[model samples]
Target: MEDTQVRDTIRSNIANKKHTSDKVMPGFFLLMASISVLTTLGIVIILVTDASKFFSAVPLKEVFSTQLAPLRETPSFGMLPLISGTLMTTLIAMLVAVPIGLAAAIFLSQFASDKLRRLLKPLMEIL
Candidate 1:
């Protein structure tokens, strides 16, 4: 029958596709993954080399100084400002994001209908 022939054709197509996937997909993925891994390893190696050179020239104690003075002949370095700035930025981001995220979660849970929540949940999750 025509239906049996169609079924045979479908099976044949799937069988051929399976062969390609079995042989090709893993090798393609491995090549792509190797490229990414090698790139990251190279970057890390370069950073470590540069950092070692810098630390050897500048003593670790100076880098951790509490006071900064760029006016003098030998300028003082204080890393406290950098650390404080990082803390401040984190605090500000949390202050803004936490309330907004909490409000969105509350709104989704309490106010939104199931259908609306279903639509919005995925969109919010993407964000």
Candidate 2:
């Protein structure tokens, strides 16, 4: 009888403590979400503004003109060399990353025990 009364009292307390939307309201959360979104949009606008200024200062002729051999008069844009360098670097990075990433994933999945796997899964997700 005492245990039953104790359980009944605990249940009543929990029922009384139940949260209702009427208490705190939802508008506060909605306002915070809107502020976060607006801040992100403002950052994007600032970055685009800075990039446009940089592009505007450089002459299009220098970027788009053709290269010429020695003693030639043709206007030359050296952008192609820069573009090729960037592509080569990107390819090298991807080549190195793909094999290493695959190896790490295979090691984790195939070699780890269940307890280690559970711990590592969350750690990887956090990263």
Candidate 3:
């Protein structure tokens, strides 16, 4: 009878703990999600503030113009060349990465076992 009482007490304690955890888990997850959202909002606010300051100092026309003359009093802020360079880089990166990624997907789908595919898929996503 004493052993049964002890077991019941232990079971009640575990049940209470599990119930408490179940109640708190959603609140904990909400707090974490709120923190992430606030952090993202803060970063976006900072970026917009800084961009506004920059645009205020530099005219919008100059940013889009394509007259880049170095060794001058005020360097030209032509964004065309930079934008083109960025686009080219993105194109090259996609050209290189897409084929390999597709090949990996095909191999995973067609050749790899279910367990190996599951493991490698997550590993590739992490990488």
RMSD per prediction, one decimal? 3.7, 7.6, 3.5
Q: Sort the predicted structures by lDDT, highest score first.
A: 1, 3, 2
As a TM-score, model 3 comes out at 0.72
Better of 2 and 3 by lDDT: 3
Cα lDDT of model 1 by residue, 34-90, tens digit? 999999999999999999997888788988888778688998777888899899999
Residues forming the 10-long window of minimal summed lDDT in candidate 2:
68-77
TM-score of each: 0.78, 0.49, 0.72
- lDDT computed for candidate 2: 0.76
The digit string of per-residue lDDT tens for model 2 on 38-107 reads 9999999999999788568756766654452334565344476677778999999999988977876787
| lDDT of each residue in 27-73, candidate 3, tens digit only | 99999999999999999999999999989987999998886664589
Off by over 4 Å in 2: 1-25, 63-92
Candidate 1 stretches with Cα past 4 Å from truth are 1-17, 67-73
lDDT of each: 0.93, 0.76, 0.93
| Model 1 per-residue lDDT at 40 | 100
